[model samples]
Target chain A: MSTPRTALVRLVAGREISVKLRDKGFLASTAVFIAIIVLAVVVPVMLEGDTPEYTVAATGHAGAVAEVAVELGGAEVPGLPAADITVIGLEDPTAGAGGDPVDEAFLRGADAVLSSDPDGTVVITAQENVPGDLEELIAAASSAVTAQDVAVEAGLSADQLAALTSPPQPRIDLLDPKPSLPVPPELVIVIFGFLFYFTVLTFGASIAQSVVEEKTSRVVEILVAAVPVRWLLAGKVLGNAAMALGQVVLIVGAGLVGAQAIGEGDIVAQVLGVSGWFLAFFVLGFLMLACLWAVAGSLASRIEELQSTTLYMQLAVMTPFFSAILIRDEGPARVALSYFPLTAPLMMPARVATGDAAAWEPWVAMVIVSATAVLLIGVGARLYSGSVLNTSTRTRLGGAWAAGGRA
Target chain B: MTDATLAVQGLTHDFGQRRALDDVSFEVRPGRLTGFVGANGAGKTTTMRAIVGVLRPDAGTVTFGGASMTLEVRRRIGYMPEERGLYPKMKVAEQLVYLARVLGVTKDDAQARAASLLEGLDLAERRDDLLHTLSLGNQQRVQVAAALIHEPDLLILDEPFSGLDPIAMDAMAERLRDRAAAGVPVLFSSHQLDLVERLCDDLVVIHHGRVVAAGDARALREQRAGRRYRVDVGGTDAWMPALAGMTVVGSGPEGTLVDLDESADPQALLAAAQAAGPVEHFARTVPSLAELFAEVVR
Candidate 1:
């Protein structure tokens, strides 16, 4: 009898594995999405070029400064020529003096505007203000010219005034490891953070969908009749866990192979090794979530209710992504999420990548998560067995369990 | 007597304030096909689900072979649920073997059984096809094959004929008969009264979640031996109330079908009806199962 049961469980697992592999659209699309993430990181790093160009818009003296900067190696904002700057030298049309400020007119026709007043002041008026980066450049140039005028009033030689206006070679370090700029560790953390959240969400959603389909189709009914609800649910969680692990292995392993082929160092291999831990938490994490999803599926009478029930589960998966945006990888906010079972599946991976999580903490956290998963499966199985077949308007937990008690 | 393969004793299940099954009791013996007949929401599926441990009843118990339907007992009972469900992404043969293997059949045995059942059901040609790729009727056949693949000692089917064409229905009926002849107890519910009459050895009729009538099929007919007369005449309805100990069951353009009490003579009923109006046809006969169902439920 035990031998048969063991074979039955294995059979279920094999069926699950075979079915997922045969689902060509899902497997292919999922591979495509993960590949896009890898490309998003690798393409930017692999490009052998200067940093991205920043577009600047201006006119008159500001335009001259921009042109000089362009000659000094800055790229111009494409499509708009210096016609607006040439027109700005015209008199304002609204003024009785016939100063037709074509720059302002051009700015009006344009999505934005730039203009200068007669009192040596520049006033920008447009449907929308320019971005602050361009505005900051204009402000810096204006201050430099004002300082040069002050130097001329001091009766210094023109060369001396030019000395005062000497270009501020600030010797800024582009590689300054500032608190604001992202570090390599931070990038690694961000990558794993996204992977953790999305993998749990995608795979967990699949588990929920599978459960609902089984219930809706009445397959669970026959299955429950044949085995204890525990074995049935356990076999499903274990089976799907194996399949999800297979997909993760395929994707992450392929990434490692690609990285090695390109001599890109072992950073990807390290990430893949870290993913083993992520996958560990993910299995326990998925088991916990899959139970809740199955419970939700059992509670609902129609397939339409699936999305609403899963909305909370999705939020649980997304909490790590949300917290990462607000705090440092090791910050208390994120650390707390790492310890939380619902959020740990995503959070711990982020911590591991950033070196915020200790070697033992993640394993301990995994233990907690696995234990909780077992507990939830028990609760979920009972609720599912009690109410899955009951199509009444109400199958409250109280009533669902007591239904079979009297008999 | 042969073992009572499945038994329900005073089973009562409630949903909130309403009762889904009330004091329902019946026995299905080996080698007999028990036809469970009921209208919509009449608890046929509920009872079947309860027996299989899919739904727990609020009161009473269901026993298979005089033993309570534990997990082991359930493994030995074949069940075809009312709501059809197959993994749409799974291949036909793969799903069949999966279900069979889950019932504790060895992997090799399950595969062999699945192959034979697919061939028997004329589904061997499409064994490798995905379930969603099949036509609706063919999918229904696979569902039946899944139920029968393990070949348990007892079978419970709910609305098995709902989606089948006439040919499939006959095949299903033949399968049930064969299973019964092999000494496996089979109980099924259907709305096809004629099929039930022809296939069932005993019948159980439930109305509003209560058993209103039950017995051997032919014996039930014998028990309702009160004479029924069809008299083709004018003013049959008007003449009905005048007859002593007689009731109007139904009437049509052909004639009025009246049931006479056991003490009332069929000859007297026809004589009185003819005296009152010009009679075109007169006959005394037994009521069809359809009519008996309507009469009992009403």
Candidate 2:
């Protein structure tokens, strides 16, 4: 009796997935992915890498404010939540007599330099526009120094000077501040981008390699005879995609568990939120690339040919990956990448994680990706069926398509 | 025309700018072992592939039981492709069961049959071993067992005996005979004419993508044999008188083997030979399948 197509596909899929379960490469990569995720949250907290560091160079009376500047910067420089500033005191008398303080400051590796002109007008030098916190810091430092000098010259003791004067600094507030995560948003994008990039490349390429293995080994002859070509294609894509998704879950689950363990409840919730969308957009997106990767596998008849055959798929996987992270903040580019089918998988969920996506935008991107996946599935099947039987080891896509027409 | 019979009629196929099979036609009747003979690239594999639907012919129909080939009908046929298409990474029994299930056997039965089939092929001890771990000859045995696991209705094996040792060959021959004895049509291809002569009940000869000769093996040999007689008379030239009505095609040892003229009669020749001396041996000659194959292909 003839086997039902679905039944045979299920059988093939079961074998594929089971085979991958035993694969050492797959298992090793899964462990690596989990470690990366867990480390992304853990390393920064342990290192206390959150505080921003700055350096300033100065000389003379204008440079004298370095002391007061250090005092205020130590006690929470207003706009910068946690910041540290170091002032380098230039002792060369010639530095102020005939040299440019800005040039000297920059040569000394300072972010900004303070110096007094012969006319005794205080000057600050910075690149482009000075950063806001540093400007506020410099201005307050200048005022407090001037006040200290005036009060101290009146013959009051240092204790009396301290009693009457404290550095009163400028404070400003914003109506909207981006919500922060335990891990930076950029790190979140790197994690998401990297997860999609690695899983798709690894899983998709494996799907193709399996196809070539069947062909080169010629076992596909028996398989193709027993079942329709489409079923073989379906079984492989579905089975490997399932493996890829399961590994994603394990890696992300480990991440969430580790996050919560470290008391990063926010990281857990944020990843959990984006991953729901990640998985939603991811399942179909991975399928499209999986189909393309399968087509790549079918094009080659030898294991040697697989490297060349899979090149385009690697590029396809890479472009969107770099795009999602590198151009995430570029408005039109991010929006375009979010809507583009190949990139939608990475872009949509990443945008949501970075809090750039509107509520309804991911929904639209998901629909587009789902549709493109359907289209790629059809094209992949055709290319796969056509090229798979060519014993020549490599054939043009059009040739395979035409050949499949006859089959 | 019965469902147990396999028929290939006017089959044609081409592999871009080269014709692989052309006007091919033949039949494998039930309860017969048909040997398909051809040189390398002589369309033997192509015809087998076309029969099993692995390759679509440019024109022709492969029918079983008087109906056109279908997936169900294909399932009923156990086809072993020429290239030995079994997975090297899979365990022997697991590979066999998997192949059988794809051919429509239930998993439990497939497993049972695989175990017994491995036992029969003397591979029972290697059942759990991966296919690549086996010797080439053993792998060949497993390849054959792969085709028989489902106990198919018809058997079409391509170069099935190419790599078997003599003992393995006999075991396989016995198994094929068992299938044929059960009234299944068995079609297989081989370049070994001696083996074919000893084993095949039917023969199909192909050369240059065309079917040159086909039918019951004995009948084909007889059909191609010429009128001839072997005679001996006291190991002497005394039967030279018989040469009047015949031409000596060969002469040695116990006789002169002669192809008779139209007017020559075997009885007349015998009488003529005895008139000269005591006739020691007189018998008509029949061609062996090997000779007939050479003659037909030549």
- Quick one: best lDDT, which candidate? 2
- Measured against the true chain A, the candidates' chain A TM-scores are 0.61, 0.70
Per-residue lDDT tens digits for candidate 2, residues B228-270, read 8888978586355545678877777777787887887878788
In candidate 1, what are the lDDT values of residues A1-407, reduced to their tens digit? 34366566666667666766767866886689668756754665577323324344456655554444333333333422212121123234666345445454544343334445776676655445664444554555565666766787778888887667664456767774433322265665666566556666766766666667776677877887787665656666677777776766666666666665555655665666567777777677777877666666666665777677677778876776777645673677778878887777767776776666788889878877888888888777777666666543435667655542432
Per-model tally of clashing residue pairs: 6, 2
Question: Against the hidden reference, what TM-scores do the models get?
Answer: 0.70, 0.82
Candidate 1 per-residue lDDT, tens place, B1-298, comes to 2475788888898966989999999988799999999899998988998888887777989988788887777888889988887788788998898888788777799899999999999999999999999998999899889889888889999888888899999998899899999998899999999989888999999998899998788888767756777788875544454577888888888787888886878888778877888888888766678988898889
Q: Candidate 1 at residue A69, lDDT?
A: 34
lDDT by candidate, in order shown: 0.73, 0.84
lDDT of 1 at B69: 81
Q: RMSD in angstroms, all models?
A: 11.9, 8.8
Report candidate 1's interface RMSD in Å.
2.6
Candidate 2: how many backbone clashes? Answer: 2
